[model samples]
Target: MTVTTDTARLPLLLTTLLLPTVARLWPAIGATADAEGWPAAKTLATLLEHEVAERASRRIQRHLIEARLPSGKTLDTFDFAAVPMVSRARIAALAEGDSWLAKGTNILCFGPPGVGKTHLSSALGHALIDAGYRVLFTRTTDLVQHLQTARQELKLASAIEKLDKYHLLVLDDLSYVQKSQAETSVLFELISARYERRSLFITANQPFGAWDSVFPDPAMTVAAIDRLVHHAIILEMNTDSYRRKSAQARAVTSDPGTTAHPN
Candidate 1:
C-alpha cells in the first residue's frame, strides 16, 4: 500500500503538539476505523480517549513514586481484624473520598508501637494516590530536621510553601521527634502553615496528654494539639501489637509438639 504524505505528516504534528500517546496509537486506531467504515470524528475521539487514559495511568505512577509510601502497605494488605477498634468502613470511606481533604481535615492515629498506625497511614496514602491525590510520606523527625535546616538558611517559608503542592502529608512516628526548641519550632511552623489549608495524616505512639514530651513547652503543646484536632478524625488503636501476635502464631506453627488452642 502506498502511504499518503498528509497521513505521514499527521504523526509528526501530533508529536509536536505533545500528544505522543495519540501520535503513537492513531495509526492502529485509524486502520481499525477504516476497516469498520467509521466516521472521521469517531476515529479522532477514539485516539483522544486512549491518550487520556494513558496520561491518567502515567500520572498515577508518578504520584505513587513521589508518595514514598512503604511498599506492600495498602488497604488490602492491612489486617483490619487485628485492630477491631478502627473501623474498616470508615477507613475505606476516607480512602475513597476527597471531601475531607478539600476541607483540610486531619487524621490522627494514636496508639502504642506496632499496632498498625504506620501501616494504616501508609495504606491511606496509597489509596489516596490511586484516587488521583498527591501524598508525601515522611518521618516526623526527618521532616523536622529538613525544616530546621531551612529555617537556619532563612528559607523556611519557601521550604514549607513547596509542600503545599501535596494534598495530603503523612507524618509517621510523630512521637520520635526530639523535644527541642529548634525541632519543635519548625514542626509547629509546619502545622501552623498548613492549618486549615492542607491536610495532615499523623501516626503517633503517644496520646494528646503526653504530647508535652514532643513539644516541650506546655503552651506550644496545647497550641499544636489544638490546631491538629480542630478538624481531625481521631483514630484510637489501643489494641495489642500485630507484631507480637504474628510472632506468637509463628512460634506455635514452628513447634510441632505444641498444640494450638482455639481462642
Candidate 2:
C-alpha cells in the first residue's frame, strides 16, 4: 500500500507515541524516553547486557565439592556485596588468562578460623565459573581422605588427574587437620601435576611459615611451596569471625518465645 509522506509520518508518530511499548518489547535495545538518552543508554545497556551474559555463562560451568566440611558452600550462595574488598573488577581480573585462574597459580587466604577466607575463595571460584572456568571445592581433610581411599583402590593417580582437570581447584581448611605421610605425598603430587597447568585456591589458618608443619618431609615441603607460591596472590583477610559475631548478635537479641535469664 502506497501512502503519502504525511500519512506515512502518522504511523511513525504512532510508533513514537508507543515508544514505551517498543522499549518493553526490546529491553535489551534500551529505548529511552528522551531522544538524546537513547543513543548513550543503548550503548551502555549493550555493554551491560554483554557483561551479564558473560557472568551468566560462567555461572553455568560445572563445579563439584567434597561435602564433609560442616559449612561447605558454593559460590552460588556467597554474598559478594558483604565482602568489602571483593570487587567485580578483582573477580574479572582473576578470570583473565594472566591472573591466578588462568595461570594455574595458587590463591592463599591465610588467617584465623571463622573469618571469611573460605567464603571469599568460594566466591572467587564461583566468579571464575561465571567466567566459564571449571572449579572444585573441597576441604583439605576430605580431599586427603578421598585420595587415601583412591590409593587403596589403585585409583590415586586417577583421582589426582580428575582434580587437575578443573581449571581452578579450591582446597579449604588446609591446615585444619594434620596430614598423614601418605596423604601429604598424594597432595604434593596433585599440586605438582597442576603446577602451571591449573589454578588452586586454598584457605589455611596457618601462615606460609607454618605450612611446613603440614608437610613433614622438608624436601617435599620446599617442593610443594615452590609450585604453589610461584604465582600466588596472598589475601590476608583479618576480619572478625563472622560466625562468632553472628552468635553474639543472636545472643544480644533474645528470641521472643524464649525466657531470658537475669543479667
Stretches of candidate 2 exceeding 4 Å from the true structure: 1-89, 95-99, 180-182, 255-263
Model 2 worst lDDT run, 10 consecutive residues: 61-70
TM-score of 2: 0.65
Give model 2's clash tally: 4
Candidate 1 C-alpha lDDT tens digits along 86-129 = 99999999997578999899999999898999999999999998
Candidate 2 per-residue C-alpha lDDT over 1-263 given as tens digits, one digit per residue, 9 for 90 to 100: 99656544544654676433333334434333244465766665664566556545444732423312224444556555545555656655765535555567778778777777877776666556545667777888878888878988999989888776678778988886565545567778788888888888889988767777677577888898889889887777666777787787797677656776799
Q: Candidate 1, which ten residues in sequence have the lowest lDDT sum? A: 176-185
Which candidate wins on TM-score?
1
Q: Give the lDDT of residue 69 in candidate 2.
A: 26
Model 2, position 124: C-alpha lDDT score: 69
